[model samples]
Target: MLDYSLDISAVERDLALPDLVAEGEELDALVSAEADWTQPTPAQGWTIAHQIAHLAAADANALIAIRTPEAFDTVLKQREAAGPHSADLEADAGAAKPRSVLLEQWREGRTELAAALRDIPLDRPFPWFGSDVTATLTVALRLMETWAHGQDIYDTLGVPHPPTTRLRHVASLGVAGIPLSFYAAQLPIPTVPFRVELTGPEGQTWVWGPEDAEQQVQGPALDFCLRVTQRRPLSDTALQATGADARKWLEIARVFL
Candidate 1:
């Protein structure tokens, strides 16, 4: 029988905070050159500035969610009135700040968020996209966001994103996101076990799901990360799907809740 439940309980709960710090520093270096700010990224119509702005806004929100409920509610209400462009509006406003100011704010914001994530109890629920969620999921979400945006920035700059063990967080998030992915797409849940087997950058095997499951996905970890993030298309990847359900899951798999 297939166990389709998305029990993230199996995933290692560690935030891998050092990995988060390293990726943040890597992105900082990418934008250190002033000219790089205006360069357009893979996100259509979004420049590098927009990419950084989006990240900064996310970090700032993390801090708000962790430290101040009142502030978070205020911002959430504002976004509600602004409608769909709400996020875009925030990003644009963030991008308008002086480059140094924006970068410093991001640095400080993420630094604070990192600290909160480090100390917060795993079971504590914090405000997230639509509901309260645990610190574990929060960090997983942040890892994917940082890595996904970094991929766009790197590709736009004609560079490769160096895959690291940190991707374990992303890979786990991708698997855990299965239920939410279906829910957001308004599709019926496929009660089929799906396995993911990937070779990490160092040739280590990283896997998810039951080995006995009939459906499986196999490939490099980087490819899995890119596909789930939607930064790169499946056609561009080397991943092989061995079952119909796995194929369909790949088509709509997304990290955001």
Candidate 2:
């Protein structure tokens, strides 16, 4: 059988930037007050400021990956040497700055990164923590990070995060992240393919993998997104798993390394 696949980088990029910007804006609005910045979020020991700072740092790193691969490799090495807490240390450093400075840096960095992502050749591989990724995947990860961290900010402020179509990007990334989830947990990657069928915010169905796959997961897209991002525990979500691998996947699912 002849296999045919189409590259959807352009489409993903188009949706990604706007959705990231929108998600950023929503979180930005909640942090206008000084007290809001220091408030502890759902992520243990993370404040609203830390969430934004992490994003700012990630955007800066992404810019380096796109603009100067060699430099990004250096940055990655530095991060590795700095150890696992490097991310928290980076966020702490950024959060220590005045709110205005951190906010401006995040805003500027995300904007610059988005613009750079647009001009890059989609086929060109960009350096990342574990491996190189295409520009399209890079932008989608940005969107996913923005949305996931934005949830922390919203939880901090006790505000309801209104569901939007943009979450489809997060859900898509979550689905793609299944194997990574296993790898991160030091578990063997499953050979059997699994199907995912989610109910989108607007009640539309979003499906991935093969329809005939014996292992399957089904749930609201938001629940799956929250699960894969590790934002919500499996017990807290309404997701259903039809196979052993599927059930195990929900237990260890995570989009980040």
Best by lDDT: 2
Model 2 earns a TM-score of 0.93
- Which stretches of candidate 2 lie above 4 Å from their native place? 1-11, 33-35
Candidate 1, 1-257: lDDT as tens digits: 11212455554446466777788888787777656487888887788888889999999888888888657888788878999887788888988888788888888888888889888887777776677766666766777799899888888888767899888888887777776677768889878887889999999998888998888999999898898888878899998988887887788888774
Which ten-residue region of model 2 has the weakest summed lDDT? 1-10
Whose TM-score is greatest here?
A: 2
Tell me how far the alpha carbon of residue 173 in candidate 1 is from the true structure, in angstroms, after superposition.
0.7
- Tell how far residue 204 is off in model 2, in angstroms: 0.3
- For residues 1-257, could you state the per-residue lDDT of candidate 2 as single tens digits? 00011223334676677777787777777676545488888988888889999999999999988888889978978898999899889999998999899999998998898789888986787788877777777777888898899888877778898888888888877777777888888999899888999999999998888999999999999999988988899999999999999999999998878
Candidate 1 residue-pair clash tally: 0
Error of 2 at 199 (Å): 0.4
